[model samples]
Target: MDLNLESLGFTKEELQERVIARICTQLLDGVGYDEDDNEFTTASQFHRQMRTSIKEKIEATINAIAEREVLPNVASYIENLTLQETNRWGEKTGEKVTFIEYLTRRAEAYMQEKVNFDGKSKEENGNGYSWSGTQTRITHLVHQHLHYSIENAMKDAMKIANSAIATGIQETVKTKLAEISTTLKVGVTSK
Candidate 1:
């Protein structure tokens, strides 16, 4: 069935976004680690722990999407929406790509480019040698999910807002078309 997102209390954008966010959050949370006894837990240590946890979550989450049967369908849906948004934004969104592809590209880029350290790389930093770059890309993915979820929720809200609008538009068009058809029928009879 062709489901119009608006009819079901969601916009196509909103539903997609909600799904993205939930998936990302769950994935990121999957990467968390527990502290060992006698480890000095400072505010910095907690922040570091959370950051690493989030990164693990994002990595596992995106990686798992590739193995799912729905990946193709989900990718197609996201691709279409990206195109639509690009059109709305009045700029070419550039080469069409799937969500899985996008995730892979971003993850790779994050690992090579962003996940560097001043004194050492992420692996070394995580071992307690020095501070490393925040896995901002992972954070970004989570943020993207949040935006999507909120949009989905908003779209759901809009379903009620446009209830009368949709009904009025449908009825008005139907009446006008019927009147024209009757007029044509009468004209034919006269001839």
Candidate 2:
């Protein structure tokens, strides 16, 4: 499937920038003190530091998703598909060809103009080996499955990131308001 991110009113780059900005703002808002135990004095300085931290975090998240989610999902799908195809071939041919050999042979035939299997040429195999029918169906199924998996993975990542930012913002706001209320109470008592 062709994914036109622009249809969502933002390009990938724009989405990345927005996410970075939002996460940085939330992180900066949560910052109560510096290394010297002094409260953050400058919004600009806090934002700069938060931007760097958020960028590193975004990179880490990307790496984690690629390693933990996308790769594993694709590998699992490929494995299952290969097994299904092997079983189908076995049932059709009534030959006990090893799965690995079957895959290798299929790959080789795909690279050639004509597919020859079980001593039968493409013509002898009817339209089974043609690119229009079975081959097209298998290709379409794999494409659709992979596309859905990847889209879901991306949505999950975005949801997690957004949730973290929102939580940080809420916590920061509560802490700052409590501090202000305490300061006001002390001033009133002193007067």
**In terms of lDDT, which candidate is strongest?**
2
**What lDDT does each candidate get?**
0.65, 0.67
Index of the highest-TM-score prediction = 2
RMSD, one per candidate, in order: 35.7, 37.6
Please provide, for model 1 over 129-175, each residue's C-alpha lDDT reduced to its tens digit, 9 standing for 90 to 100.
Answer: 55566555455556668889999999988997799789999999999
Candidate 2: worst 10 consecutive residues by lDDT? 112-121
Candidate 2 per-residue lDDT, tens place, 98-182, comes to: 5566788787655443323233345656766452222433454566688899999999999999999999999999999999998
Q: Kindly report which residue stretches of model 2 are placed more than 4 angstroms away from their true locations once superposed.
A: 1-135, 185-191
Which regions of candidate 1 fall more than 4 Å away from where they truly are? Answer: 1-145, 157-165, 185-191
